[model samples]
Target: MAKFFQKNKTIHDENKLEIVSDKSPFAYVEAYKTLRTNMNFLSRNSQYKKLLLTSSIPGEGKSSVSINLARVLAENGKRVLLIDCDMRKPMLHRYLRAQRFRSRGLSTVLSGNSTLEESIATFSDLQFDLMTAGPIPPNPTELLASAEMGNLLELLETRYDYIICDTPPVSLVTDAAILSEYCDGVLLVVRQKYATFQQVKRAKQNLQNVHAQILGCVLNQYDVSKNVRESAGSAYYHYQYGDTKLASDGMMQ
Candidate 1:
């Protein structure tokens, strides 16, 4: 519901990356809170703890959305654990500025090289814990679809109020669809002007093929300038709930 503009940079730009923090802009922070509220509303009647975030393609701001969504949930006093499942191009560690702890993460724990406790990185400032995509494995898809991945989710579900996984684009890899089986619901992140209609349609079909519960879609990097009279200079992220019909009709514009 809040609006703001990001100047001269996309959400994926490392130099001008936008993240929700205590010091973040009021509009930016409020936007994520709104998203969290919608998510809670959608899952009020169901147990939707383990959530997976993916996109139709790369650079759609799915990782950023995953991080901010997890943060907002944690801020609401929920026990949250964010995992970087995008091992092929893991960016959560860099986004969190916790590169030092990335040496041991989900990959390490799943591969039996490290214990779960040792791989999870805890931040003093954050209410939630994080699991970076530890050294990229040669078999990302295989590792994710392994029994260990399901076991890991089962264990974490007992310990945390929410376990949010940031997985690769659905159209690009089977990782998202594979992990969606272990999740309660899947939220697709669609970036404005970046994703094509066919791409989103294909992404949706891929998830459907696996029977992944598609909760909704988050419209990222939306150009608010066209919609809001005062928001003429910048673009902002918007969240939307994509029903079955909406998704089937290609939600991207």
Candidate 2:
């Protein structure tokens, strides 16, 4: 994995904006690879392909995790398709620096205005494709829950090894839960010191209400300086797979 990295490059292009996961430090990328490995193990015996990633609220780095996870899978030679289903605040295109193609994404395809084949933006360098949250629609929730979206995912599943979706915060809107029904499983993100126990509890409730299979939780944005002090002053990123059980403190542990 180290040999394949693009050395000396930072994980962000400018203003800590655009994604550079491929260029991230070995530890950062390794953390994501760990996530990829755990996910593979969890679904090894099952045909779980369409996975939805969501947090309890916005700004928890759910989108970031989704993008990096997809990239890691692609790096391993999987045909991965990442979709920005977070219509309310779609940022995958911006993060990927593929904004020019965001106008023809998930929303547009679900509205009967475009085809998935034509809407996706291919990132040749990353070896993965993306479907942005096309022109935030008037009713993101409705569009996602509609039959069209379900059919679209089914069709896409046949063409890709993984369909990783980044949806609106589960507690913010019903979109994540609505889309969850179509996914093989759901990965909830918990940003340390940010996401509250109450919020995550509710988010889990939302997912459970729709009978979405909870694969596990991702512990994101762990402060390496405070605890894992050795990574001070560097681009430190920590990702942990919490126990399958959802703890009362508002995270999976």
Candidate 3:
């Protein structure tokens, strides 16, 4: 069974508590912190603080990375707000084990059903905030692409240090590409052994077509044993877009 995430016995859902502060071992804690550190250099200006995290396809651990990154940021004393923009398949609420699910999220705020204050749920203990997917709506794409979404993001930048959003897959839906317009940059999460280079390349092109800034990529669940021995101790190819190349063990470097 996978360690980071597993299916819950009763809920039949998969949610992992691999956060650094409350749980996680030394390497996991240090890994998320290092990811936070690299992200710190993204921008000195808080105005440009929105970072959208997405993946090429489902089951690639984008939501996992987003929540973990948010936790690490909050641990560093930053007021982080993680919004589950993947209204179709919201998992942030599941990850937090929220008591219930209702119209208390981006959808409600976008549709004027509720105020932003009411939509946001504060993780009192975790020190970060979360905006769930709210009630599943029929027109998810329209709501995500509307001017209301842009306005909400702009308003959030004033209140949160970082607005990290977990969105739907780029190839699967237009939501990720559409939401990318409001974000400062987009981070692609690629699960090693699952996502192919071509799929990630297409995802990047999709983001680029939308004019979203490419922050880099996060290679998750990367096992170095097989490839490491094969390469005889060589640096992993972290990211290769066109001519640019930057490699790290796991976090975006």
Candidate 4:
């Protein structure tokens, strides 16, 4: 069985910022192989030049996962763009402390109130571009379902090696599901213990009903101890099966 990782949540002094520099031994490398494997799989199959990272409900850590995954992909030499598509309550900008970019983003561009070039904001230091949700619109879902929204993603696909969108939770609103069809693939983030199996199953079905290609799931905030025990059980089950099969063959001989 593959070993599970032990990660302790860091307590940063009031700044409320998560310092996840690649220098931290566990920051990028420990999770690099796992993230890279997922990225490679998406890159090869699904024709997924663009991806949407969303959850069944809020507080599932979809934004953080999208950011880290984009960073990992950039580290692997892929040109990645992470867009904040949660207009109702935009937090990606706050997460990264990027305030200037939010003024002109997806809502601005999609509403025909701003040009695509004017709407996008780049972070050269991060090596990944970001498009914020922009000024909260009166109707976010309707705007996202519009043709302009589709054109914008198509335009981004031509410009970036990988386009990752951090959208609003599907179960909370239909925004994510509406945007799912526009994306090349959808990656669902399931919160450990918080997100129920039924919630994930329903989210998958929702994506399927929309004909969105679900890339798979990323189980966030997973407990290392519990996962290890579960993995050990699976290994034991497989080992027992193998031994029984071998014994049966020997008896037949």
Q: How close is every model to the real structure, measured as TM-score? A: 0.83, 0.84, 0.82, 0.79
Instruction: Give, for candidate 3, the lowest lDDT window spanning 10 residues.
Output: 229-238
Q: How many clashes (backbone N, Cα, C below 3 Å) per candidate?
A: 0, 1, 0, 0
Clashing pairs in 2: 197-250
Please, what are the lDDT tens digits per residue for candidate 4 over residues 42-86? Answer: 678657888898887665667767766776677677888888888
Better of 1 and 4 by lDDT: 1
Please give the range of 10 consecutive residues that has the lowest summed lDDT in model 1. 244-253
The lDDT of each candidate is 0.77, 0.74, 0.73, 0.67
Q: How accurate locally is residue 63 in candidate 2, as Cα lDDT from 0 to 100? A: 72
Alpha-carbon shift of residue 211 in model 4 (angstroms): 1.8
What TM-score number comes out for model 4? 0.79
lDDT of 4 at 219: 69
Q: Which candidate is the best by lDDT?
A: 1
By the TM-score metric, which is better: model 1 or model 3? Answer: 1
Q: Candidate 1 lDDT, tens digit per residue, 27-98?
A: 566677888988888768899999999999766778777877887898898889999998887877776676
